[model samples]
Target: MRLFPRAGPTASMVSATSIVVSGGIAVRGIGLLKLIYAAHVFGTSDAQDAFLEAFLLPSLLSDVLAAAVAPALIPALIRASTEGRTAGAVALYRAAFGAGLATTLVAALVLGLFFPFALPVLASGFGKEKSALTLRLLLVMLPLLPLTACNVLWRCILNAGNRFVLAALAPVATPLASLAVLYFGAARWGIQALAIGAVAGSAVEGILLAQGVYRLGYPLIPKLKGALNRLGPVLQQFGTILLSSVLFGCIPLIDNAMAAGLATGSLSVFGFGTKLATVILSLGPASIATGALPQLSRLAVVGDWRVMRGSLLHFGKLILLVTVPIVAVLMLFSGQLVRVVFQKGAFSTQAAYEVALVQRYSLLQVPLAVISALGFRLASSMAANELVIPAAGVGVAVAALADYQLRRILGVQGIALASVVTQLSVIATLGFLLKRRMSKQRLGVHTEAVPPGGDAL
Candidate 1:
């Protein structure tokens, strides 16, 4: 028997895909279980809102720092390492780690000082006591910012080094750690336990990612120069990407926040629906997009326009293929889904209707949202040209304005509609931009290859 089985990039992709998809399933299962336990244990509108609100800034900040950098960092690092620029790859790691540490600390301080000011804006429906609890939770959760960002840096490095299985599986560590906090600590520590769980999860995730990086012969060090010089470009693009991600994300965030204010327990309803939608989006679309980044980057370097285009088309079709079925199921039996998932202990049938409404509306984004996420990742992976950001920003602005205008009139459902509309806008813009970039890459290849009107037949 051959000791080292013959394999190539294609085999790597197949194996990585299996690992990612399975990891997603595992994470999703943990998430479902946690939500069930939390609903039972916390069991109140206020408790749900407190946890969600405390989570809001940290979650969004993670998106801005870790996730924003993950796709961007992985492709660039892969290119650097493949081209024998080991120092450049190492420099990238150092820069990202420094940035994460600095950014997280700054964000934590800002949250500490300003969280009180923002609390009223976020949880306007809560009484002073509930609002204070929310604020306390925010302070506790803020520390996770730096911790989570470090986790992302390590994970991105590992993924770039083609250690996909560990990179994929590492995320599950956080949720499992959180489950322990909820199971044992919630009763004694109250909502603080949830916050502790998040922080502990971040620490575990960071350690796991760091261990994987070390195994791949990469060290975590602080390099100020590369981070400083290259950061301008990355940060500029990141700012736009952050805006786009936030704006797009703000749709549901605002919807959930607003609904929570309107009716008691409305927050939980919206949250339950959002989590369900996340299962589909994260497992299928996000997994594929993430899995494809390194390949896309390599294709860009080799000027493989045809393969890139075909890959993009495959991604779009893949999203539709997976999302259509999910949409059908959610549209047909949203209440049942919500009921089976929650609807016990503190959750009531009335809460189910509110959650069902959000879920049913979320079905509108089924195919569109999945395609948009793929488009964004695909565009970012193609040399980090930063085309997806402005287009996404435009969509977000549209969603925010629509959300504000429609929230009062249509309520939570309106918020969902706004989200759907913005996501469709993003899908359209990203699709067009991807085509244009592919054409440019093709034209550039043609111009460089054929010099002075000389053709050999």
Candidate 2:
């Protein structure tokens, strides 16, 4: 019913949250290191853009698919586990894997085929040489499409079984592989090494995750018929989720596409600007919010308005208190942070200034994102998924329109501002819908026809 936890606790809550956040930071640190290394090698060149753009697409597509797939698949797995020694659950896992394999292949095939035709128009700002390089890197990296899609599938399956350690650490493969490439091959192979490493790292992640799932006893052996037969219920749950996932995930792509039409290095600037915000969210509030979900769900189930509102407010305040100062420091030291993190190699003084400017704007997302994370968990605990879908759609629309209007006057900084605008609108809308839903007092414990394992988290 709710977002997610460690024994519904205070000290344990902190412990659980700390572990989640710290682990995320540790894992992501490797990837961030890879990026820093790449920055040194590539700077804001066509090569870097080509690597980022090449990498961004399949990654984005896989993430969008994973976002919707995991949540929808969870409910189905829980239901299946109630059947017979998780026999149905295992069957469903196989089915999901099979279907994911089939579908991701089809999607990748279509994308690979259409990319050449579509690239000229979508990335019209790309010159002949730049576009050609992006195409090469993308094709080399495309096989990861299946690797990534499968990684998402297995990761969700493992999480459903309460096996998260591997899921968390497994992602390190991507960055680790990339780092190796950047270190050993950057001079010889240039960005092609980056592309190759990405595909290889994803493959490693896929292997490790598949192993974990099998050890958990859900081997994803391929079976088309099984997948087709079991697809109905999952598909039914998938439609709304797909829309929200697409909308929410589109913001970066929107920025990238819009930035493609701008000056040569805009894509990297936009990415670098937003990088610290990502670190802040993952290292702090997002982790707490995720680990803190189960407690909020408990309170929601009790349906005590005073307790619910008070607990929610307190948690939100605590999250903000911990983060706001960090946000302030980051804003103040944006330039210094950029210099320390990415100013070496081909990166220059002027590029750092421009990146810092955008970073100041993008850093605003930290507080807004945490608030939204907590709010979304609250909505989930209240079973208000319906409210979130349209809110996300509205956010995506706002992002596109704002980026267009702002990019003209403000350039890349305007694009960063547009993201902030989207978050503000979505959160405001979600807050309103959540308030109305809470007023209905419809969040009481569900004793009627409870599912076999009860509501997860």
Candidate 3:
């Protein structure tokens, strides 16, 4: 087998991974620009803190749910395709599209209605005006979660067909839209421009993805009839994965909320640093996982553990190859990177130094974070999400204690340290589960069963 396959599924794997990575860099570039622009505009101010938390709520919810639910749909998709029936796969897509669309809207509505109360928990340090602003901003951005959910589901359909380019590049729309808003409207509209940009951009991406899915012969309309029953196992797996997503997803909210009480600008500084660090750390692993999942799931379906293990190692190596040097640079010149990347307009010298420290602290977890991401993706391919919920629970429990203790001693950097600790705890738990799971990778296959006399989407 070629290390870099040129034909066959492995080749598609390599090709897709390549598109996702190269495309991811471009997308992240635009995202970094938005961060830089926002930093220039808001700096380490109360307003910036409020904006970050408000915006963050939607982003975290979108990613945690979108990323989890989409992959859960993948194995079932691949199984249906493997059985040589596009109708079965298309039905799964319909149920997923409708269910995701409806579920996220309900969630968004609940959160929007309660944001006034939730704002205190989301950012406890905010005073009356800041909380008021956050509530307003959040209402505008609340739709982002549902928009993102629908978009990712569309991407899921496209990717299931081995067509990934639109999805890979679609994210560019959000940041680009945000940047245009900031550049053109920030003077007049303030941070509200960013909120508008986020929703608008996601809607645009949805349009693009919808067209792609339609071009591939899938209907544009969502069908929820018999969705729960049709989505039996996928629905079951989604619940388990969503539970894990929520467990892990709440950490950032808590971390930022904790930072809010420390100092006027502590939350902003920590948010800035972590955003920069996480974007860097996750880029390689995220792309590799997205590109490789279908291939991994296919291999696991055939019980080819040996080649599956090889693919895992190769993918892991690819991550390290991209990350090690980046990590070294981040550690060594973090201060300079912070300065060059963000220190501008309102972002002061002191703020840059503090952010640099947080970056270094967050960097320590990169290796294990990378490993854990790969482990989780591999488990997802094998439909072993049950293990993830417990692992995430352990991590969240550890985060609560670690954040409480570390923040008392170290301030915002302590929260960064807490993240490293949390990742360590989660990876340890996952390692144990994967060891047991590997033995049953073949026999333990769990996918949505094609219902008898059904799949009439």
Candidate 4:
């Protein structure tokens, strides 16, 4: 595939890409430092395992809310703005913000209340002490649900307006706060310090993003009037995307549950490895996809299918160019990477080796995972959000089965392999569906030539 247009990437695209990628790298760098600190301080102890498991619910809720809303919302906002319907766009944002806040509040309350009963089932392997500790940490973390949802909503709004830097950089505070708290208080407060740090971080992140949104001239005071009318289509699209997210989101929970059933430190090892892989993902595919979404949405609004097709293809090549080499290096030097990052203080050489094993398999999914992320965003931009759900469902089922069967043989490595297989399966199925849809639409046939040096924003 061609790496670039004959004239090369436009200045606007290059500028936007650089801003998003650099911001993402900075955020991930802070996160990596936090992880390294956590590894050194907590290692793979039961306290660490409890903290990781406790974090699962709140983090999953945040991701699901963000993923479900952002893709659908950004496109709608772009379309409305393009059509000079700024009032309608602002109203829609309010409605989404209000609805998301309410939903997060309700979910947090329900989860908090029910966690006492559900903790046993979710972490069945934990003893009474560990399980109780997890419950306490979870309750403290529950407030993060609403804070995170708002932060994500504001970030999406800023992104839709092409203000990528602030949106991307605002999240850096979360890790910074967490790292500081852990550094100063881990001895006195133990795992609970992490929880406190997370809540503090979420607060900072939300405030910074909210300020960014306001500075962009979007109203923070939500106007719910006419929001329902504008939200009808958005909600419909969100439902399909949310369903897909929930289906795929459960895979990690399932993996964690299975890991809990293994040895004492299995959950920590798996969590560490997964976090490392996510750092790579956020830096490349996730960053590229985020930068591309606004452009894709604008293109779709203008019926620029030919350009959209070309853009998608170009993105695929770009993502692979970055992801493939990183995956290779990580797989080949997994032990070295793990030791360099995690083997300190409480983290033992054996712990590093175990994490390395899982990291190697998890890194295998980086390229496929990136492609799948981009594909889903492209599909959402075209209002084909419902198309990938079946593929995701199938992938999740396969992952569960694989986790069950593989864990019996390879332990944590088996779980990691299952995740890789799931991503591959999902990407294959989704890519085929996307290609078939584009073929049917004849998107490859250029209908109108885009002007040279057109800005993607």
The regions of model 2 sitting more than 4 angstroms off are: 1-16, 79-85, 282-318, 441-457
- Model 4, residue 216: distance off in Å is 2.0
lDDT of each: 0.70, 0.75, 0.79, 0.80
Give the range of the ten consecutive residues with the poorest summed lDDT in model 2: 448-457
| TM-score of each candidate structure, all chains considered together | 0.87, 0.87, 0.92, 0.92
lDDT of 2 by residue, 1-457 (tens): 2223223344434554665666687778898898888898889998887777877778878877866786567666755654444878777778878888888899889989988997875666788899899999889988988887789888777666656577777878988987897799888988899988888888888898989988888766766785766767676556666877787888888888898889889888888878778778666654654455444434433544355444555566767877899889989988888889988979999899889989999888888988887776566555566677878888989999999999999999999888889989989999898787777765643323212222211
The pairs that clash in candidate 3 are none
> Where does candidate 4 stray beyond 4 Å?
5-14, 224-226, 381-383, 435-457
Which should have the higher TM-score, number 1 or number 4? 4
Question: What is the number of backbone collisions in each predicted candidate, taken in the order shown?
Answer: 0, 2, 0, 0
Candidate 3's C-alpha runs over 4 A off are: 1-12, 378-383, 436-457
What are the clashing pairs of model 1? none
Pull out the clashing pairs in model 2: 2-381, 4-294
lDDT at position 224, candidate 2: 73
lDDT string for model 4 (1-457, tens) is 4455444323345456779888888888988898888878888989999999999989988888877777768888888898998877778888888887888899999999988897777777899999989998999899999898889889889989988989888888988999999999988998888899999999998888888888877878755566666688777767777888898888888899989999899999999987778777767666766777777777767777657766766766766876788778778988887888898999998888889999988888888887787777667544466668888888988898999999999999899999888988898888788777767657654233322112221
